[model samples]
Structure formats: structure tokens, C-alpha cells
Target: MRLTVTFFTSMLSKVVNQINISADLNCGFELACQWRNNTAGEDSGDFLITSNVRVANHFNIIPSRNNSDELFAYTHGPFDGMQKATLISNTISCQLGGGTLTFWYYRTGDSATLEVCVRQPPGSLNTADLRCFPVFPKNYAHQWLFNAVEFPPLTQPFEVVFLV
Candidate 1:
């Protein structure tokens, strides 16, 4: 499946002054992928950081919601099958009431699918343990769409995983 995912956190305004801190500490911070290209001889570890992705004859350019140049993307390859690609966020320590996760996604092709999941214990990727949110994206292709999922108060640090 070919999927492009972009994330923006409204909570960034709370700690804008502490931009140097790791995102894990801020809980609510912009999530951008580190520069990597699967087709350029780099480690194609499930996901890649890119600004643009082309599908068939349609080219999609994803402008960062955080005012950055690049967004994270999952490209389709010849080997695509039941294989899954995941993009996991840093551990988030929510406040007393928790918060909402908002992001933009662009999907192309008939088989493309995306899911937002919350996992406790941070590093666990076990499918059975994932608490997936029922947030689904619209069926429109070639255009970016917005989606938000609200989470309850979390006493322990947890991670949000974007599975495609």
C-alpha cells in the first residue's frame, strides 16, 4: 500500500519556548520524519521521510502543517503484499484530561489503508496489544484530509502508532 502521513499537534503552543527539548518530553509536539528515501539506497525501514510521492500519473506534494519542508511517507513497491509499514510517535505524557491527536493524510490507490493506534509500554508493537482508534479517513484520493482522535487521561506514558 502507498500512504502519506503528516502530523501536527495543537499543543505545540504550550511549549514553543522549549523547542530544543525532545518531543517525548513535550508530549504535544510536531512529528516530522527524519530524512530518508527508500529508493535512494537508504534503509527503507517501513516508512520514509519525504515531501512528495507519486502514484501512477498523479503527483502529490505534502506541505508540512508545522511549516516544515518534509513529511513522512510510505511508498508502494513491487514487493507490496500483506506487509505493513508503521510510523510510531514518541512517548506522550498527557495532562489530567488527555488530549486530541490531529493529522492530515493522503491516500491513493484502491488498496491503501491507514490506522491510528495507541499502545502502552511504549515499545511494544504486538498487534494484539494495540488499542486502535476508530478514526477513519475519507475515501477521497489525491487530496489531503484532516482527522482527529481524542484520547482519555493517561497516567502512564504511551505511544501513538500510525500503521499503513
Candidate 2:
């Protein structure tokens, strides 16, 4: 069957059908995908605004810098109690619009929070840059869960970054 693509009248009202993230990401970060076109009686079929990128974390739980003293750091959590970390993203060359960053994390802490950020000019190398945080002090279950954030208008390439 041929699929006919029609322009969506209301961009904000487009319902997202499914949002998914990968747990065992080789890049050490989770990704989110949202199916918004399905809500408008169209099967966009994995039309993602954001691509698989990086996530950021809190400095207290996870060190902001790596052992090499690099700004993009990655440190394992402590074994005794809950641990948290934030992942930073590289330059996201978006091919489509309305890409969502989906994050998958293990709920180590009873009340842990993960943050995902996206900058207007990706890879600004400035913590004080423009960012969008999906969850602030988000409460997670004791199991591996998937969380997603959505965007609209798959128009241009956008940078995808995150904080936790």
C-alpha cells in the first residue's frame, strides 16, 4: 500500500505513539525515539527528531571531569549506595526534525534524578548554555526503565545533549 504524507495542521497536538530507549548503548548513553506521526493518522515509522547522542549528569554523584581531566567524563558509580552521573553530548547533526532524547537508566537511588539537555548551538562547551531539562529530581522505580522527551518539526539538524 502507498503511504500518503500530509502536513500536520497542529504541530503541538501531534500525539506521540511510542517512545523507546536503548539500555546497552555502546556509547554509554541511552537514546529516545518518539512516534508522533502515528498520532496524526500517519505512520512516520521511527521519524526521530533527535539522534542517538550523549547524556549529562550531576557533578556531586559523578565527577564532572574524567580521570584524564577531560570535560567529557565517565566514571562508574559507587558500589555501596546509589550513584548518579551526567553525560554530555557531541555535535548532533540532525537529519530530521522533532527528535527526542530517550534515556534508559538503572534506578540505583530511591530518589535519583537524571537530566537531558539540548543546546541551540550544539557543543558550545559552556555549561551555562541554553538547555532543556526533561526531569528534575525524577523518581524512578527499582528496575531498568525507559524515559523519553519529545520535540517537533523535523526540519533541520539539531544538537542532542543531556544532563543527569
Candidate 3:
């Protein structure tokens, strides 16, 4: 007996915007941000540049210890436990291999964390959903370092986010 062969066709639907967080905070980074502070004097916003990364600005040199010519940092003043920087990204279509959410960080406060997380489409993630890899815990190093977390495979679209 001979075997028969069959073939099926599938069409690609939505397109995914591959995002890489540029040092300028525009790597497809959406600023649906919010913060709670003890006073209104705090200046907290989306991801900002810092001149403390152990790594150089390999992309375009926004701001770093080596290149302090440009001021790329967004701060919440010298306050703590009150000021927060939560960066939320726009939705991105998940692909076969998924993608990575990365950034260069330099820690300052002893009680601060660069919490990395992702959001499922439609609904966002809560603190319980945070499973940060490549964590850069609060350290006085103030040295630039890269944190890259890979997104697991997802059938639908999703967003990558983290708080500073």
C-alpha cells in the first residue's frame, strides 16, 4: 500500500512590534505611568537615563558614567518609600521564540528594586505576577549593568514591563 500526503495552509494575522528599550526610554516604551508620593516635590516619571551603568551606551550613548555629556536621568528627588517609577510598555504580539525585556540599570537606594514583569493582553500584571530574572537588586554599585529577561511563548499578544 502507498501512503498519501496532505498539506495545510495558514495565514499570518496580527503583526508584532519588536521592542528594545533604547536608552532614551522610547524602545516602543509606552508611558502609562503612575506614582504615589508623600509630597508633590518628587519628580517621578517613566524610565530615564542614568550615568552609572557598568556597561557603556553601546547603542547610541544616551548617558553613562563614561559619557556624562547628556543628562538622561529621571528622578524622584531624594525621597524614598514614597516615590516610584513604574514603566509600562505597549502590547506586543508574542512569537515562537518570544522576546527579551532588557534595560541598563544602576541601583542607588538600599530598599529599591528594578522589578521586571510582563502583562497578558487585555489585563495587566499585579505585584504577584512579577517573576523578575536577571535581577539587579538595590545596590550602591551605581554601576551600569544590563538586565535581560526572556519572554516565554504566548499565543496572543502581551506587554513587558517593570518598575524602577
Error of 2 at 57 (Å): 23
Q: Provide the global lDDT of candidate 2 against the true structure.
A: 0.34
After superposition of all CA atoms, the RMSD between model 2 and the true structure is 18.1
- What's the CA error at residue 27 for candidate 2, in Å? 5.5
Please name the candidate that would achieve the greatest lDDT relative to the true structure. Answer: 1
List, residue by residue over 1-164, the lDDT tens digit for candidate 1.
44444333222111222122234332222353222122222224355445555655555555645465644444454224555555565556543576676766555544555667777876664567687885455565566677877777776766666655
Candidate achieving the largest TM-score? 1
For candidate 2, give the lDDT of residue 74.
Answer: 26
Judge candidate 2 at residue 150 and give its lDDT: 74
TM-score of 2: 0.41
TM-score of each: 0.63, 0.41, 0.53
RMSD for all candidates, in order, please. Answer: 7.0, 18.1, 16.4
* Candidate models: Cα lDDT each: 0.51, 0.34, 0.40
Model 3: per-residue Cα lDDT over 1-164, one tens digit each: 11111001011112233433322223211221221111222225433433322222222323444534433333333335454555444455554676664555544444555555665652333445444553654444544566666777666655554545
lDDT of 2 by residue, 1-164 (tens): 11111111111113333212321112321222221122322111221221111223321322222442211112233312233233333334443545555544443443334455565564355656655665534554433355667755433333444333
Sorted by TM-score (best first), the order is 1, 3, 2
Question: Which candidate do you rate higher for TM-score, 2 or 3?
Answer: 3
